[model samples]
Target: MKAKARAHANIALIKYWGKSDENLSLPMNSSLSLTLDAFYTETEVEFTNSINEDVFFLNGVEDKNTLSKISKFLDLFRIARNMNERAIIKTINYVPTAAGLASSASGFAALAAATNKASGLDVNSRELSTFARRGSGSATRSIYGGIVEWQKGINDKTSFAVEIDDASWDIGMVVVIVNREEKKMSSREGMKSTILTSPFYKNWPEDSQKDLKEIKIAIKEKDFEKMGYITERNALKMHATMLGANPPIMYFEPKSILVMQIVHELRDKGIPCFFTMDAGPNVKILCRLSQGEMIKNRLMEDFKEYEIIVTGPGPGVEII
Candidate 1:
Protein backbone atom coordinates (compact mmCIF):
# COMPACT_ATOMS: atom_id res chain seq x y z
CA MET A 1 0.00 0.00 0.00
CA LYS A 2 1.23 3.49 -0.89
CA ALA A 3 0.25 6.62 1.04
CA LYS A 4 0.54 9.92 -0.85
CA ALA A 5 -0.45 13.45 0.25
CA ARG A 6 -1.15 17.08 -0.76
CA ALA A 7 -2.09 20.49 0.79
CA HIS A 8 -3.58 24.09 0.66
CA ALA A 9 -6.57 26.28 -0.37
CA ASN A 10 -6.80 28.25 -3.63
CA ILE A 11 -8.61 31.63 -3.47
CA ALA A 12 -10.02 33.04 -6.67
CA LEU A 13 -8.76 36.34 -7.99
CA ILE A 14 -10.56 36.06 -11.29
CA LYS A 15 -13.53 33.91 -10.28
CA TYR A 16 -15.27 31.30 -12.39
CA TRP A 17 -18.77 32.75 -12.51
CA GLY A 18 -20.27 30.67 -15.30
CA LYS A 19 -19.73 27.54 -17.32
CA SER A 20 -20.25 26.86 -20.97
CA ASP A 21 -20.38 23.16 -20.15
CA GLU A 22 -21.11 22.12 -16.60
CA ASN A 23 -20.29 18.45 -16.99
CA LEU A 24 -16.76 19.21 -18.16
CA SER A 25 -16.48 22.08 -15.65
CA LEU A 26 -15.62 24.33 -18.58
CA PRO A 27 -15.63 27.93 -17.47
CA MET A 28 -17.23 30.69 -19.50
CA ASN A 29 -13.99 32.64 -19.02
CA SER A 30 -10.49 32.23 -17.71
CA SER A 31 -9.97 32.72 -13.98
CA LEU A 32 -7.04 33.21 -11.61
CA SER A 33 -6.68 31.92 -8.04
CA LEU A 34 -4.23 31.96 -5.14
CA THR A 35 -3.24 28.83 -3.27
CA LEU A 36 -3.32 29.67 0.47
CA ASP A 37 -1.89 28.04 3.60
CA ALA A 38 -4.63 28.57 6.19
CA PHE A 39 -6.81 25.80 4.74
CA TYR A 40 -6.24 22.62 2.74
CA THR A 41 -6.94 18.91 2.28
CA GLU A 42 -4.76 15.82 2.35
CA THR A 43 -5.29 12.60 0.43
CA GLU A 44 -3.76 9.17 0.07
CA VAL A 45 -4.40 6.45 -2.48
CA GLU A 46 -3.53 2.78 -2.43
CA PHE A 47 -4.26 -0.06 -4.82
CA THR A 48 -5.87 -2.33 -2.33
CA ASN A 49 -5.75 -5.85 -3.72
CA SER A 50 -8.82 -6.77 -1.68
CA ILE A 51 -10.89 -3.57 -1.85
CA ASN A 52 -13.19 -2.87 -4.80
CA GLU A 53 -14.06 0.83 -4.64
CA ASP A 54 -12.86 4.16 -3.29
CA VAL A 55 -13.16 5.43 0.32
CA PHE A 56 -13.30 8.96 1.77
CA PHE A 57 -13.13 10.52 5.21
CA LEU A 58 -13.44 13.98 6.71
CA ASN A 59 -11.49 14.25 9.91
CA GLY A 60 -12.32 10.63 10.82
CA VAL A 61 -15.87 10.09 9.59
CA GLU A 62 -16.43 7.88 6.54
CA ASP A 63 -18.81 8.85 3.74
CA LYS A 64 -19.80 6.50 0.93
CA ASN A 65 -20.99 9.10 -1.57
CA THR A 66 -17.99 11.28 -0.88
CA LEU A 67 -15.90 8.19 -1.49
CA SER A 68 -17.62 7.71 -4.80
CA LYS A 69 -16.75 11.25 -5.81
CA ILE A 70 -13.10 10.59 -5.05
CA SER A 71 -13.37 7.44 -7.09
CA LYS A 72 -14.53 9.50 -10.01
CA PHE A 73 -11.55 11.75 -9.50
CA LEU A 74 -9.22 8.75 -9.49
CA ASP A 75 -10.76 7.37 -12.64
CA LEU A 76 -10.00 10.64 -14.39
CA PHE A 77 -6.49 10.75 -13.03
CA ARG A 78 -5.76 7.19 -14.05
CA ILE A 79 -7.10 7.76 -17.51
CA ALA A 80 -4.99 10.87 -17.88
CA ARG A 81 -1.90 8.98 -16.79
CA ASN A 82 -2.80 5.92 -18.88
CA MET A 83 -2.08 3.88 -15.83
CA ASN A 84 -2.37 0.11 -15.93
CA GLU A 85 -4.11 -0.04 -12.53
CA ARG A 86 -6.71 2.00 -10.65
CA ALA A 87 -6.99 2.23 -6.86
CA ILE A 88 -8.95 3.32 -3.80
CA ILE A 89 -8.60 6.89 -2.48
CA LYS A 90 -8.72 7.96 1.16
CA THR A 91 -8.75 11.67 1.93
CA ILE A 92 -9.25 14.12 4.84
CA ASN A 93 -9.78 17.86 4.91
CA TYR A 94 -8.38 19.74 7.91
CA VAL A 95 -10.61 22.79 7.69
CA PRO A 96 -13.69 23.18 9.89
CA THR A 97 -16.81 21.43 8.61
CA ALA A 98 -18.62 23.63 6.06
CA ALA A 99 -16.89 26.90 6.87
CA GLY A 100 -17.25 27.90 3.21
CA LEU A 101 -13.47 27.89 2.85
CA ALA A 102 -12.84 24.41 1.62
CA SER A 103 -13.73 24.26 -2.04
CA SER A 104 -13.51 20.91 -3.80
CA ALA A 105 -10.40 22.43 -5.38
CA SER A 106 -8.19 21.48 -2.48
CA GLY A 107 -9.76 18.05 -2.15
CA PHE A 108 -9.49 17.01 -5.79
CA ALA A 109 -6.10 18.67 -6.17
CA ALA A 110 -4.78 16.72 -3.23
CA LEU A 111 -6.47 13.58 -4.44
CA ALA A 112 -4.99 13.82 -7.94
CA ALA A 113 -1.54 14.55 -6.60
CA ALA A 114 -1.78 11.63 -4.20
CA THR A 115 -3.08 9.33 -6.86
CA ASN A 116 -0.10 10.14 -9.04
CA LYS A 117 2.28 9.29 -6.22
CA ALA A 118 0.48 6.11 -5.19
CA SER A 119 0.31 4.74 -8.72
CA GLY A 120 3.75 5.97 -9.80
CA LEU A 121 2.19 8.11 -12.49
CA ASP A 122 4.38 10.87 -13.87
CA VAL A 123 2.44 13.78 -15.30
CA ASN A 124 2.88 17.54 -15.56
CA SER A 125 0.76 20.17 -13.81
CA ARG A 126 -1.31 20.71 -16.93
CA GLU A 127 -2.22 17.05 -17.12
CA LEU A 128 -2.89 17.00 -13.38
CA SER A 129 -5.05 20.09 -13.71
CA THR A 130 -7.16 18.54 -16.44
CA PHE A 131 -7.57 15.41 -14.37
CA ALA A 132 -8.51 17.42 -11.28
CA ARG A 133 -10.89 19.64 -13.24
CA ARG A 134 -12.91 16.54 -14.09
CA GLY A 135 -13.56 16.22 -10.36
CA SER A 136 -14.33 19.88 -9.49
CA GLY A 137 -14.44 23.24 -11.23
CA SER A 138 -11.92 24.95 -8.94
CA ALA A 139 -9.47 22.13 -8.45
CA THR A 140 -7.47 23.01 -11.55
CA ARG A 141 -5.96 25.99 -9.75
CA SER A 142 -4.68 23.71 -7.02
CA ILE A 143 -2.26 21.92 -9.34
CA TYR A 144 0.32 24.68 -9.10
CA GLY A 145 2.07 25.74 -5.92
CA GLY A 146 1.04 29.38 -6.12
CA ILE A 147 -1.12 31.65 -8.27
CA VAL A 148 -2.72 29.79 -11.17
CA GLU A 149 -5.03 30.46 -14.09
CA TRP A 150 -7.55 27.95 -15.34
CA GLN A 151 -8.24 28.72 -18.98
CA LYS A 152 -11.80 27.90 -20.00
CA GLY A 153 -10.92 25.09 -22.31
CA ILE A 154 -13.48 24.78 -25.12
CA ASN A 155 -13.31 21.11 -24.35
CA ASP A 156 -11.59 18.76 -21.90
CA LYS A 157 -8.59 18.37 -24.20
CA THR A 158 -7.75 22.06 -24.30
CA SER A 159 -9.04 23.17 -20.86
CA PHE A 160 -6.55 23.19 -17.99
CA ALA A 161 -4.91 25.41 -15.37
CA VAL A 162 -1.45 26.99 -15.64
CA GLU A 163 0.89 28.59 -13.12
CA ILE A 164 0.78 32.37 -13.01
CA ASP A 165 3.27 33.13 -10.26
CA ASP A 166 4.72 31.98 -6.95
CA ALA A 167 2.59 34.62 -5.15
CA SER A 168 5.33 35.30 -2.62
CA TRP A 169 3.89 38.73 -1.89
CA ASP A 170 2.82 40.63 1.22
CA ILE A 171 -0.90 40.23 0.60
CA GLY A 172 -3.10 38.43 3.15
CA MET A 173 -6.72 37.28 3.33
CA VAL A 174 -8.95 38.48 6.22
CA VAL A 175 -11.96 36.16 6.11
CA VAL A 176 -15.16 37.51 7.72
CA ILE A 177 -17.73 34.75 8.10
CA VAL A 178 -21.05 36.57 8.05
CA ASN A 179 -24.47 35.03 8.66
CA ARG A 180 -22.48 32.35 10.49
CA GLU A 181 -25.33 30.84 8.56
CA GLU A 182 -24.38 29.12 5.36
CA LYS A 183 -26.16 30.00 2.16
CA LYS A 184 -28.74 27.45 1.10
CA MET A 185 -27.57 27.81 -2.49
CA SER A 186 -24.35 26.05 -3.30
CA SER A 187 -21.82 27.79 -5.57
CA ARG A 188 -22.71 25.36 -8.37
CA GLU A 189 -26.43 26.25 -8.21
CA GLY A 190 -25.61 29.94 -8.01
CA MET A 191 -23.58 29.64 -11.20
CA LYS A 192 -26.40 27.76 -12.92
CA SER A 193 -28.91 30.46 -12.06
CA THR A 194 -26.53 33.19 -13.16
CA ILE A 195 -25.93 31.50 -16.46
CA LEU A 196 -29.62 30.85 -17.06
CA THR A 197 -31.16 34.09 -15.79
CA SER A 198 -28.71 36.93 -15.14
CA PRO A 199 -28.90 39.66 -17.75
CA PHE A 200 -25.45 40.69 -16.59
CA TYR A 201 -24.31 37.44 -18.06
CA LYS A 202 -23.95 39.50 -21.20
CA ASN A 203 -21.57 41.88 -19.44
CA TRP A 204 -19.29 39.08 -18.23
CA PRO A 205 -17.41 38.86 -21.52
CA GLU A 206 -16.04 42.37 -21.09
CA ASP A 207 -15.77 42.66 -17.30
CA SER A 208 -14.37 39.24 -16.52
CA GLN A 209 -11.68 39.51 -19.16
CA LYS A 210 -10.74 42.97 -17.92
CA ASP A 211 -10.36 41.63 -14.40
CA LEU A 212 -8.22 38.77 -15.62
CA LYS A 213 -5.87 41.08 -17.49
CA GLU A 214 -5.46 43.61 -14.69
CA ILE A 215 -4.93 40.88 -12.09
CA LYS A 216 -2.22 39.34 -14.23
CA ILE A 217 -0.44 42.67 -14.48
CA ALA A 218 -0.82 43.32 -10.76
CA ILE A 219 0.76 39.98 -9.98
CA LYS A 220 3.63 40.76 -12.32
CA GLU A 221 4.22 44.10 -10.60
CA LYS A 222 3.47 42.74 -7.12
CA ASP A 223 1.29 45.79 -6.54
CA PHE A 224 -1.25 45.33 -3.74
CA GLU A 225 -3.40 48.37 -4.57
CA LYS A 226 -3.83 47.33 -8.17
CA MET A 227 -4.49 43.78 -7.14
CA GLY A 228 -7.08 44.76 -4.52
CA TYR A 229 -8.96 47.08 -6.87
CA ILE A 230 -9.32 44.44 -9.58
CA THR A 231 -10.25 41.63 -7.19
CA GLU A 232 -12.87 43.65 -5.28
CA ARG A 233 -14.57 44.93 -8.42
CA ASN A 234 -14.48 41.56 -10.11
CA ALA A 235 -16.00 39.91 -7.05
CA LEU A 236 -18.75 42.56 -6.78
CA LYS A 237 -19.58 42.08 -10.44
CA MET A 238 -19.70 38.34 -9.93
CA HIS A 239 -22.13 38.78 -7.04
CA ALA A 240 -24.28 41.11 -9.16
CA THR A 241 -25.05 38.20 -11.46
CA MET A 242 -27.23 36.75 -8.71
CA LEU A 243 -29.48 39.83 -8.50
CA GLY A 244 -30.10 39.59 -12.22
CA ALA A 245 -31.63 36.14 -11.74
CA ASN A 246 -35.33 35.70 -12.67
CA PRO A 247 -36.37 35.57 -9.02
CA PRO A 248 -33.61 38.06 -8.13
CA ILE A 249 -31.99 36.44 -5.12
CA MET A 250 -29.07 37.76 -3.07
CA TYR A 251 -26.54 35.99 -0.94
CA PHE A 252 -25.78 39.05 1.13
CA GLU A 253 -27.58 39.43 4.44
CA PRO A 254 -27.79 42.82 6.21
CA LYS A 255 -24.74 41.68 8.16
CA SER A 256 -22.84 40.97 4.98
CA ILE A 257 -23.14 44.54 3.79
CA LEU A 258 -22.28 45.68 7.30
CA VAL A 259 -19.05 43.69 7.09
CA MET A 260 -18.14 45.50 3.89
CA GLN A 261 -18.92 48.79 5.65
CA ILE A 262 -16.56 47.83 8.44
CA VAL A 263 -13.90 47.25 5.83
CA HIS A 264 -14.47 50.65 4.26
CA GLU A 265 -14.43 52.44 7.60
CA LEU A 266 -11.13 50.81 8.33
CA ARG A 267 -9.81 52.06 5.00
CA ASP A 268 -11.10 55.54 5.85
CA LYS A 269 -8.93 55.36 8.96
CA GLY A 270 -5.97 54.83 6.59
CA ILE A 271 -6.04 51.07 6.85
CA PRO A 272 -5.00 49.49 3.57
CA CYS A 273 -7.70 46.97 2.79
CA PHE A 274 -10.25 45.95 0.19
CA PHE A 275 -12.91 43.25 0.52
CA THR A 276 -14.38 40.69 -1.86
CA MET A 277 -17.31 38.34 -1.44
CA ASP A 278 -17.81 35.01 -3.11
CA ALA A 279 -21.26 33.52 -3.87
CA GLY A 280 -22.12 34.01 -0.17
CA PRO A 281 -21.99 36.80 2.43
CA ASN A 282 -18.60 35.89 3.82
CA VAL A 283 -16.01 38.48 2.78
CA LYS A 284 -12.36 37.84 2.08
CA ILE A 285 -10.43 41.03 2.72
CA LEU A 286 -7.17 41.50 0.86
CA CYS A 287 -4.61 43.51 2.76
CA ARG A 288 -0.91 44.09 3.21
CA LEU A 289 1.05 42.54 6.06
CA SER A 290 1.70 45.90 7.73
CA GLN A 291 -1.94 46.93 7.40
CA GLY A 292 -3.28 43.72 8.92
CA GLU A 293 -3.36 45.14 12.47
CA MET A 294 -5.26 48.28 11.49
CA ILE A 295 -7.69 46.24 9.41
CA LYS A 296 -8.30 43.88 12.31
CA ASN A 297 -8.88 46.83 14.69
CA ARG A 298 -11.66 48.16 12.47
CA LEU A 299 -13.21 44.72 12.05
CA MET A 300 -13.10 44.35 15.84
CA GLU A 301 -15.08 47.55 16.30
CA ASP A 302 -17.90 46.14 14.17
CA PHE A 303 -17.57 42.42 14.74
CA LYS A 304 -16.28 42.17 18.27
CA GLU A 305 -16.98 38.49 18.67
CA TYR A 306 -15.90 37.45 15.21
CA GLU A 307 -12.23 36.78 14.82
CA ILE A 308 -10.57 37.94 11.61
CA ILE A 309 -8.63 35.08 10.08
CA VAL A 310 -5.09 35.80 8.89
CA THR A 311 -3.63 33.73 6.05
CA GLY A 312 -0.84 34.03 3.53
CA PRO A 313 0.19 32.14 0.37
CA GLY A 314 0.09 28.36 0.80
CA PRO A 315 1.95 25.82 -1.25
CA GLY A 316 0.17 23.11 -3.22
CA VAL A 317 -0.10 19.42 -2.26
CA GLU A 318 2.90 17.68 -0.81
CA ILE A 319 3.62 15.34 2.05
CA ILE A 320 2.29 16.49 5.42
Candidate 2:
Protein backbone atom coordinates (compact mmCIF):
# COMPACT_ATOMS: atom_id res chain seq x y z
CA MET A 1 0.00 0.00 0.00
CA LYS A 2 1.13 3.53 -0.76
CA ALA A 3 -0.11 6.97 0.30
CA LYS A 4 0.97 10.58 0.20
CA ALA A 5 -0.16 13.62 2.22
CA ARG A 6 0.61 17.27 2.74
CA ALA A 7 -0.03 19.53 5.76
CA HIS A 8 0.74 23.20 6.46
CA ALA A 9 2.71 24.67 9.36
CA ASN A 10 0.81 26.56 12.10
CA ILE A 11 1.98 29.50 14.23
CA ALA A 12 0.59 29.59 17.71
CA LEU A 13 -1.17 32.82 18.70
CA ILE A 14 -1.84 31.62 22.25
CA LYS A 15 1.17 29.45 22.90
CA TYR A 16 1.32 26.12 24.74
CA TRP A 17 4.59 26.27 26.61
CA GLY A 18 4.32 23.37 29.05
CA LYS A 19 2.78 19.96 29.33
CA SER A 20 1.00 18.10 32.08
CA ASP A 21 1.61 14.70 30.54
CA GLU A 22 4.78 14.65 28.53
CA ASN A 23 4.44 11.03 27.53
CA LEU A 24 1.08 11.59 25.91
CA SER A 25 2.16 15.03 24.68
CA LEU A 26 -0.78 16.72 26.36
CA PRO A 27 -0.51 20.46 26.78
CA MET A 28 -0.73 22.23 30.14
CA ASN A 29 -2.93 24.88 28.51
CA SER A 30 -5.00 25.32 25.39
CA SER A 31 -3.41 26.85 22.26
CA LEU A 32 -4.68 28.57 19.12
CA SER A 33 -2.86 28.81 15.78
CA LEU A 34 -3.11 30.03 12.20
CA THR A 35 -2.10 27.55 9.51
CA LEU A 36 -0.05 29.33 6.84
CA ASP A 37 0.30 28.45 3.17
CA ALA A 38 3.94 29.55 2.89
CA PHE A 39 5.35 26.55 4.78
CA TYR A 40 4.35 22.92 4.78
CA THR A 41 5.48 19.28 4.60
CA GLU A 42 4.71 16.53 2.18
CA THR A 43 5.15 12.89 3.13
CA GLU A 44 4.87 9.59 1.27
CA VAL A 45 4.61 6.14 2.82
CA GLU A 46 4.76 2.65 1.38
CA PHE A 47 4.19 -0.59 3.27
CA THR A 48 5.22 -3.94 1.89
CA ASN A 49 5.92 -7.48 3.07
CA SER A 50 9.45 -7.29 1.71
CA ILE A 51 10.92 -4.68 4.04
CA ASN A 52 12.79 -5.82 7.16
CA GLU A 53 12.32 -2.59 9.20
CA ASP A 54 10.96 0.92 8.99
CA VAL A 55 13.06 3.42 7.03
CA PHE A 56 12.85 7.24 7.20
CA PHE A 57 14.26 9.87 4.85
CA LEU A 58 14.15 13.65 4.90
CA ASN A 59 14.98 15.77 1.88
CA GLY A 60 16.74 12.80 0.23
CA VAL A 61 18.92 12.17 3.28
CA GLU A 62 18.65 9.23 5.66
CA ASP A 63 18.47 10.89 9.04
CA LYS A 64 18.91 8.52 12.01
CA ASN A 65 17.60 10.83 14.75
CA THR A 66 14.57 11.69 12.70
CA LEU A 67 14.26 8.05 11.73
CA SER A 68 14.05 6.89 15.34
CA LYS A 69 11.28 9.36 16.14
CA ILE A 70 9.32 8.39 13.05
CA SER A 71 9.76 4.75 13.84
CA LYS A 72 8.29 5.23 17.30
CA PHE A 73 5.32 7.01 15.80
CA LEU A 74 4.85 4.24 13.28
CA ASP A 75 4.81 1.72 16.11
CA LEU A 76 1.75 3.44 17.49
CA PHE A 77 -0.04 3.13 14.19
CA ARG A 78 0.98 -0.51 13.84
CA ILE A 79 -0.22 -1.37 17.32
CA ALA A 80 -3.61 0.13 16.56
CA ARG A 81 -3.97 -1.69 13.28
CA ASN A 82 -2.31 -4.90 14.51
CA MET A 83 -0.04 -4.99 11.49
CA ASN A 84 3.64 -5.95 11.75
CA GLU A 85 4.78 -4.98 8.28
CA ARG A 86 7.31 -2.17 8.16
CA ALA A 87 6.94 0.97 6.06
CA ILE A 88 9.34 3.29 4.24
CA ILE A 89 8.64 6.97 4.80
CA LYS A 90 10.01 9.93 2.82
CA THR A 91 9.20 13.50 3.87
CA ILE A 92 10.09 16.83 2.25
CA ASN A 93 9.71 20.11 4.09
CA TYR A 94 9.04 23.53 2.62
CA VAL A 95 9.90 25.28 5.90
CA PRO A 96 13.02 25.55 8.01
CA THR A 97 13.45 22.54 10.29
CA ALA A 98 14.14 23.50 13.92
CA ALA A 99 14.42 27.28 14.00
CA GLY A 100 11.22 27.97 15.96
CA LEU A 101 9.05 27.52 12.94
CA ALA A 102 6.29 24.88 13.39
CA SER A 103 8.02 22.36 11.17
CA SER A 104 7.15 19.47 13.49
CA ALA A 105 3.51 20.48 13.35
CA SER A 106 3.30 20.04 9.61
CA GLY A 107 5.79 17.19 9.51
CA PHE A 108 3.92 14.84 11.82
CA ALA A 109 0.53 15.88 10.53
CA ALA A 110 1.58 14.78 7.09
CA LEU A 111 3.10 11.59 8.50
CA ALA A 112 -0.03 10.64 10.41
CA ALA A 113 -2.18 11.21 7.35
CA ALA A 114 0.16 9.21 5.14
CA THR A 115 0.62 6.31 7.53
CA ASN A 116 -3.07 6.01 8.32
CA LYS A 117 -4.03 5.87 4.69
CA ALA A 118 -1.24 3.51 3.65
CA SER A 119 -2.10 1.13 6.46
CA GLY A 120 -5.77 1.08 5.51
CA LEU A 121 -6.95 2.77 8.70
CA ASP A 122 -10.19 4.70 8.76
CA VAL A 123 -10.17 7.63 11.16
CA ASN A 124 -11.60 11.16 11.32
CA SER A 125 -9.70 14.42 11.76
CA ARG A 126 -10.20 14.33 15.54
CA GLU A 127 -8.54 10.93 15.78
CA LEU A 128 -5.86 12.07 13.37
CA SER A 129 -5.17 15.08 15.60
CA THR A 130 -4.62 12.81 18.57
CA PHE A 131 -2.19 10.67 16.59
CA ALA A 132 -0.34 13.75 15.39
CA ARG A 133 -0.13 15.07 18.96
CA ARG A 134 1.83 12.01 20.04
CA GLY A 135 4.50 13.23 17.60
CA SER A 136 4.27 16.98 18.37
CA GLY A 137 1.76 18.79 20.56
CA SER A 138 1.25 21.71 18.19
CA ALA A 139 0.61 19.19 15.41
CA THR A 140 -2.88 18.68 16.77
CA ARG A 141 -3.77 22.16 15.54
CA SER A 142 -2.03 21.62 12.23
CA ILE A 143 -4.56 18.94 11.35
CA TYR A 144 -7.06 21.72 10.66
CA GLY A 145 -6.94 24.73 8.37
CA GLY A 146 -7.35 28.45 9.08
CA ILE A 147 -7.60 29.39 12.76
CA VAL A 148 -7.57 26.22 14.87
CA GLU A 149 -7.74 25.81 18.64
CA TRP A 150 -6.42 22.85 20.63
CA GLN A 151 -8.37 22.07 23.77
CA LYS A 152 -6.11 21.00 26.65
CA GLY A 153 -8.08 17.93 27.56
CA ILE A 154 -7.75 15.97 30.77
CA ASN A 155 -6.69 12.88 28.86
CA ASP A 156 -5.32 11.76 25.52
CA LYS A 157 -8.71 10.91 24.04
CA THR A 158 -10.14 14.28 24.96
CA SER A 159 -7.40 16.54 23.59
CA PHE A 160 -8.06 17.48 19.97
CA ALA A 161 -8.23 20.54 17.72
CA VAL A 162 -11.07 22.15 15.81
CA GLU A 163 -11.33 24.90 13.22
CA ILE A 164 -12.33 28.22 14.77
CA ASP A 165 -12.78 30.09 11.51
CA ASP A 166 -12.04 29.87 7.82
CA ALA A 167 -9.82 32.95 8.28
CA SER A 168 -11.19 34.39 5.04
CA TRP A 169 -11.22 38.04 6.11
CA ASP A 170 -8.04 39.07 4.31
CA ILE A 171 -5.82 37.99 7.20
CA GLY A 172 -2.18 37.06 6.51
CA MET A 173 1.24 36.68 8.13
CA VAL A 174 4.80 37.67 7.19
CA VAL A 175 7.37 35.14 8.42
CA VAL A 176 10.73 36.77 9.20
CA ILE A 177 13.46 34.14 9.09
CA VAL A 178 16.44 35.46 11.04
CA ASN A 179 18.46 32.32 11.87
CA ARG A 180 18.12 28.96 10.15
CA GLU A 181 20.33 27.03 12.54
CA GLU A 182 18.84 24.38 14.81
CA LYS A 183 17.82 25.69 18.21
CA LYS A 184 20.48 25.12 20.87
CA MET A 185 17.83 24.08 23.40
CA SER A 186 15.19 21.80 22.01
CA SER A 187 11.60 22.77 22.79
CA ARG A 188 11.23 19.70 25.01
CA GLU A 189 14.25 20.66 27.08
CA GLY A 190 13.29 24.32 27.18
CA MET A 191 9.77 23.57 28.34
CA LYS A 192 11.04 21.28 31.08
CA SER A 193 13.62 23.81 32.18
CA THR A 194 11.12 26.65 32.33
CA ILE A 195 8.54 24.55 34.14
CA LEU A 196 11.02 23.47 36.77
CA THR A 197 12.86 26.77 37.33
CA SER A 198 10.75 29.74 36.25
CA PRO A 199 8.38 31.20 38.83
CA PHE A 200 6.60 33.13 36.09
CA TYR A 201 5.67 29.86 34.41
CA LYS A 202 3.35 28.93 37.27
CA ASN A 203 0.69 31.28 35.98
CA TRP A 204 1.29 30.88 32.25
CA PRO A 205 -1.51 28.41 31.76
CA GLU A 206 -4.07 30.67 33.42
CA ASP A 207 -3.01 33.70 31.39
CA SER A 208 -2.97 31.71 28.16
CA GLN A 209 -6.48 30.47 28.85
CA LYS A 210 -7.65 34.04 29.11
CA ASP A 211 -5.87 34.88 25.88
CA LEU A 212 -7.46 31.97 24.03
CA LYS A 213 -10.92 33.15 25.08
CA GLU A 214 -10.36 36.75 24.00
CA ILE A 215 -8.77 35.76 20.67
CA LYS A 216 -11.66 33.45 19.77
CA ILE A 217 -14.11 36.28 20.34
CA ALA A 218 -12.03 38.62 18.21
CA ILE A 219 -11.90 36.07 15.42
CA LYS A 220 -15.66 35.70 15.61
CA GLU A 221 -16.05 39.41 15.07
CA LYS A 222 -13.37 39.60 12.36
CA ASP A 223 -11.54 42.29 14.37
CA PHE A 224 -7.94 42.15 13.16
CA GLU A 225 -6.66 44.72 15.65
CA LYS A 226 -8.12 42.88 18.60
CA MET A 227 -6.74 39.56 17.40
CA GLY A 228 -3.29 41.00 16.71
CA TYR A 229 -3.11 42.71 20.11
CA ILE A 230 -3.94 39.59 22.07
CA THR A 231 -1.61 37.46 19.96
CA GLU A 232 1.36 39.80 20.50
CA ARG A 233 0.72 40.00 24.22
CA ASN A 234 0.38 36.25 24.53
CA ALA A 235 3.66 35.60 22.71
CA LEU A 236 5.52 38.10 24.92
CA LYS A 237 4.15 36.46 28.03
CA MET A 238 5.29 33.04 26.81
CA HIS A 239 8.83 34.34 26.24
CA ALA A 240 8.85 36.17 29.57
CA THR A 241 8.36 32.92 31.41
CA MET A 242 11.35 31.45 29.58
CA LEU A 243 13.47 34.45 30.52
CA GLY A 244 12.60 33.97 34.17
CA ALA A 245 14.21 30.56 34.20
CA ASN A 246 17.26 29.94 36.38
CA PRO A 247 19.75 30.63 33.59
CA PRO A 248 17.58 33.33 32.00
CA ILE A 249 16.89 31.50 28.77
CA MET A 250 17.08 33.81 25.79
CA TYR A 251 15.91 32.98 22.25
CA PHE A 252 15.71 36.40 20.66
CA GLU A 253 18.79 37.57 18.84
CA PRO A 254 19.62 41.25 18.27
CA LYS A 255 18.01 41.10 14.86
CA SER A 256 14.82 39.76 16.41
CA ILE A 257 14.47 42.92 18.46
CA LEU A 258 15.17 44.99 15.37
CA VAL A 259 12.28 43.34 13.53
CA MET A 260 9.93 43.75 16.50
CA GLN A 261 10.74 47.45 16.70
CA ILE A 262 9.96 47.78 13.03
CA VAL A 263 6.54 46.22 13.59
CA HIS A 264 5.84 48.61 16.46
CA GLU A 265 6.86 51.51 14.26
CA LEU A 266 4.48 50.41 11.52
CA ARG A 267 1.64 50.06 14.03
CA ASP A 268 2.18 53.62 15.27
CA LYS A 269 1.88 54.89 11.70
CA GLY A 270 -1.71 53.48 11.43
CA ILE A 271 -0.84 50.14 9.88
CA PRO A 272 -2.65 47.45 11.83
CA CYS A 273 -0.01 44.80 12.60
CA PHE A 274 1.55 42.91 15.51
CA PHE A 275 4.60 40.69 16.02
CA THR A 276 4.97 37.27 17.71
CA MET A 277 8.04 35.11 18.30
CA ASP A 278 8.28 31.42 19.12
CA ALA A 279 11.24 29.52 20.59
CA GLY A 280 13.63 31.05 18.02
CA PRO A 281 14.84 34.45 16.84
CA ASN A 282 12.47 34.72 13.90
CA VAL A 283 9.42 36.97 14.29
CA LYS A 284 6.05 36.51 12.60
CA ILE A 285 4.04 39.63 11.90
CA LEU A 286 0.30 39.21 11.66
CA CYS A 287 -1.32 41.79 9.43
CA ARG A 288 -4.06 42.26 6.86
CA LEU A 289 -3.56 40.99 3.30
CA SER A 290 -4.16 44.54 2.07
CA GLN A 291 -1.03 45.70 3.95
CA GLY A 292 1.16 42.61 3.40
CA GLU A 293 3.14 44.18 0.55
CA MET A 294 3.71 47.45 2.44
CA ILE A 295 4.89 45.60 5.53
CA LYS A 296 7.27 43.40 3.51
CA ASN A 297 8.72 46.37 1.59
CA ARG A 298 9.34 48.25 4.83
CA LEU A 299 11.10 45.30 6.49
CA MET A 300 13.13 44.50 3.37
CA GLU A 301 15.00 47.80 3.78
CA ASP A 302 16.62 46.63 7.06
CA PHE A 303 16.49 42.85 6.66
CA LYS A 304 17.89 42.35 3.19
CA GLU A 305 19.70 39.16 4.24
CA TYR A 306 16.73 37.63 6.01
CA GLU A 307 14.03 35.77 4.08
CA ILE A 308 10.54 37.21 4.46
CA ILE A 309 7.59 35.01 3.51
CA VAL A 310 4.06 36.39 3.09
CA THR A 311 1.22 33.89 3.27
CA GLY A 312 -2.48 33.60 3.90
CA PRO A 313 -4.57 30.84 5.50
CA GLY A 314 -3.71 27.27 4.44
CA PRO A 315 -5.78 24.12 4.20
CA GLY A 316 -5.75 21.02 6.39
CA VAL A 317 -4.18 17.62 5.70
CA GLU A 318 -4.97 16.21 2.26
CA ILE A 319 -4.15 12.99 0.48
CA ILE A 320 -2.10 13.48 -2.66
Best-matching candidate per TM-score: 2
User: Best candidate, lDDT-wise?
Assistant: 2
The residue pairs in collision within model 2 are: none
- The ten-residue window of minimal lDDT in model 2 covers 94-103
Which 10 consecutive positions of candidate 1 have the poorest summed lDDT? 94-103
Local lDDT at 71 for model 2: 88
The CA lDDT at 4 in model 2 is: 98
What TM-score fits each model?
A: 0.92, 0.98
In Å, residue 180's CA in model 1 sits off its true spot by 4.1
- List where candidate 2 sits over 4 angstroms from the true fold: 96-98
- Sequence-dependent TM-score of model 2: 0.98
After superposition, candidate 1 runs with Cα above 4 Å error: 80-86
Error of 2 at 25 (Å): 0.3
Each prediction's RMSD to truth? 2.0, 0.9
